[model samples]
Target: MAEFYHSVTLIEEKCVGCTNCIKRCPTEAIRIRGGKAVIASERCIDCGECIRICPHHAKRARHTHLSRLSDFTYKIALPAPALYGQFNNLDDIDYVLNGLKQMGFDDVFEVSRAAELVSEATRKLMVSGKIKRPVISSACPAVVRLIRVRFPDLCDHVLPLKSPMETAAAMAKQEAAERTGLPPEQIGCFFLTPCPAKVTDIKMPLGIEKSQVDGAIAISEVFPELSQKMDHLETVETIANSGVIGVSWATSGGESAALLNEKYLAADGIENVIRVLEEIEDERIGELEFIELNACAGGCVGGVLCVENPYVAKARIQRLRKYLPVSQNHLMGGPIPELMGWEAGLEFSNALTLSADLKQAMQMMVDIDSMEEELPGLDCGACGAPTCRAFAEDVIRGGCEKTDCIFIYRKQMQKVADTISKLDGLKQFSKEEKKD
Candidate 1:
């Protein structure tokens, strides 16, 4: 069965045998062979890191193009809060919203509106005292997948709210249809996404039965048009509907600010987030109810699929926050969206959904363990596999042969040399051939 999204793939022609991606992948999903890169699907988390780092732009995120929106009678744009950080001097919210319209989206919805709902939901979850301490954010799909694969034990601590993208997609679809008298199918809710993981999330939702999002357009794909559109539009910043609290959801610590909880902590970037999650899993940060983790540094603003410099984007985001109107007290008002029953019970499936059978995985694991013990431990990527264990899995999967392992190949060469020497002693033809 094909996976819903293969986050990382190879562009054979662009590869220069640099081996950069093989070393950077968190899951060790990439390999270099025949002077090109290859992706191992089962190990990929779809973080989009490789896409950002590839100078040749060989790595591409799988996203729906804006033209796909033509299929629907009504099109609504649901821009992730991180999308706001893509442009410099984008202090005016209206200009940003209008930019989406100019790009052919009929309507624009703030992901912060869903952030408002998420904020309310998170506050209630913290106050209800029903969850285990240090509730993890489900906003970042990469972070969620990391928990599933590496920190499976910490699955219980994750907050169950559907991601802000899901929240806004649902709200936009339901409201657009109700107000416009269109069927749900006629209304397209397109997410302006930061990474490929969100694309995969929309295709295969974790901890939820289904996602409300119709499709997604990559931010990088639409950024050029948005930039051109912004040149003519007047600045229009709308803060009354969803204020600063919701808008803050874009960057690191933005969730904590929305919650107005000083006790909780927010962390961003994959490696940093993983380290913090590991500590949390070990009970290092005890008695905390909220943990916001974003896979990209500086939050979604720093996503791999983004166009602008992340640091400059983060600064622009800080300026935009000043105009937002959501206050802690205003957010506390009755009927907060958070009170709307958004939480879901998180239960991880032990069965590897990516694999066809347990027997194959077990056999692969055994082979991996054996090969790993014999490896040089340098993780050099010279053998065309990201790691020795990965090479073993490739051998088991038939993508590679045992000789792909440098150590195994060396051993075979030694045996060949010994056999040639032994044959030299018994050779009657060797001397005759040399004379000839």
Candidate 2:
């Protein structure tokens, strides 16, 4: 098995082997082994569920530091719209944008602007009726990975458009290179991400060959500095690019609402998204034109990296939206003409593929079914697997033994004791016959 890069990593020393993460993980990607939580890299979607649920704070998001900004000649900050919700009594977004410049970014570009473009593009795509019903949002990398791993059948329904972060990075890099008369390599575009999944997306992007963004910095890592700067700053640059529709992308139903179409559905939280995907798989949601899914509850505001309570953040975002001008005009008149088509380069990750050989895989499935029947069906994590079915799969994959399950071990021990008792009785009967 090849090792893949993961944004969410465990600090083993801090782990208490608590089952909080195991239960919260939407994909069941975590297991307790040797008194530590172990993340199955292939199974993980970097949704940050473990990071949020862990009491010990053992899970951390791996992201670029502010010091990395010094490496590039020009630095562009691509701040997510969710950043606005992190602060209290923040009336102006300009303060936050300007604060990025004080923190070493040469220029700041709002990802919300790119979101406007994506919104327009999606609406146009929806209008064309070229895509499958209930076209899934590609903005949430975690959701996309979940589909790839658990719902491969619905992979085609995932909208092929690039995420706002990616689009903004690409656009910023191009614009920076042109304006500065410097090569693209000299211009670094760093995304101010609200979640670990976005960091992973930058490191290992889907749909695109290479990420335009040079790196990702967690919003939590920069919040303190930004807040301080905002508190004392006398003058701030204007953030005029993004409108209400774009900035609203930070919360649940934002994208769908931006489309101005009633047929779209927006689902937030990975569990809810999973339920919606299952419905799509069952052909129950064919009437919908689009579906926006975010891995975090309350959308990006509920991201593990975010500091504010999701409900509070969502309220702030709604308040901010009320102040911004609303226009019927589509921003950027849809995505750039070059990026309008489906992403033919993208393919399903297929992380859940049992085996390469169909016949062998079928046999393994049969074996798993047989093994499951013998299990207690408690779905306990004592054996380090989330469910009895999962335990059976683990046994089939040689990751565990039937004896590892306490119930199975007890049954085997009882059988051995019965055999020994029967042998003793036979020996006693034979001895009695000899005496007679």
Candidate 3:
């Protein structure tokens, strides 16, 4: 099993105690306390929505500094498709690839190439008899983790395939190592990431045991230098082989459009996807074959770490799409035979069943119900948890004292009133001094 790590953390000093993130959090993982925000690890999906919303720039994504590349004998850059939309008038893709090489990389590998391979794999899954009616895309690691942690029953539907980024890293490293006659560790395969989720995926992979990616640098952190190079440099003609469909994977509905499967329904942004998932759970979306959910609003291009504005980035992607080769009609034939049965089974440490026992979980639910009955349902988040129900869970888990609940405070006040009423005879003797 993959030992997943979420080292891409929110710096508490940078946070400004904003409720914007609290509202955007899909898992309701963040809570404000002591004039600061805190992230609950068990509940965080690492979707990067908080990173995108913080106004004071308190939210920052940690990535490998360019200085670290000097230690490696040969460095390879794997730019995600979202990186392509970061620059204006980037007339040629080679400008981006060559620019990375100039920025200290020995070579640049297009992540879109891996997308090509993934596209082939996706097509094969559709044709294969093993897959059920709708095979969910495993491209978004955050979505995959969300399913594993929050919606364990829906895990089986995730297509058993590595993401384009991982596939690109695997292939690029293998080929680069073979050519350079160096070990895998010597050749660092760094991804130019679009969001914190990808950073988390690289550090602590989801469905796979060990991720092929070595490290990632957020696009927003690297865009300044990359954009400068594109401004004045002459473009070189490179293999533009990553199919059109593969390039499309950077957008919200790119996967569905690439697969061109009619039964599929792709929804972008975390909250929107959750709403759809709820409908699915309620059995309202039974007719749909496949569902694609992207936590980022405009997909990877509108990710938290991109330099270009969301609308501009999306428009560039659309324009960039016209120049690429079509994936469906490509001459690459079909997926390799090995890819047909490729299965990356569930990657988890402990049993994916609820963390608490069924009895305990039910009791927690009951406690939450009682707390809601007693307290106001304003969702003020004043008690440190995002909601009153969450506060109740904290009490049940022994993380909080019951007296801290607002409703309990009110009840205690009532008890004090009753005690004072019983002491009314003693209060009459004290009133004479007050009148004088």
lDDT of 3 at 229: 65
lDDT of 2 by residue, 1-436 (tens): 2357899999999998876788788887888888888999989999998888888999999999989998899999999989998877666778889888888888999998888888888888878877777888888999999988898888888888888888888888888888999999899999988999998888787887678889899898999998887777778778557778888999989888988899889999988998999999999997788899999999999898888899999999988877677633354543446653335644666566778899999999999999999999988778877788888998998987889888999999999999999999999999999999
lDDT of 2 at 352: 68
Tens digit of per-residue lDDT, candidate 1, span 1-436: 3764664566677888787788778777778877888776656778888887888878877888888998999999998877788777766677878878877887888888878778777787788877778888888888888787777788878887777788788888888888999999899999998888988888777877677788888888888888888787665444325667777888888888778787888888888997898899888998676889998988888887787777788888889888766543234455445423445666554433335577877777787778677777776677887676666666766778888777778999999999998898769578888889
What is the TM-score of each predicted model, taking all chains together?
0.86, 0.95, 0.89
Candidates 2 and 3, the one with greater lDDT: 2
lDDT for each candidate structure: 0.78, 0.86, 0.75
For model 1 the TM-score comes to 0.86
Q: Write the per-residue lDDT of candidate 3 for residues 194-214, one digit (tens) a residue.
A: 888888887777666678788
Following a full C-alpha superposition, what root-mean-square deviation does model 1 have from the true structure?
4.1
Q: Where's the lowest-lDDT run of ten residues in candidate 3?
A: 347-356
> Clashes per prediction?
7, 0, 1
Q: How does candidate 2 score on lDDT?
A: 0.86
lDDT of 3: 0.75
- Give residue 145's lDDT in candidate 3 (0 to 100): 75
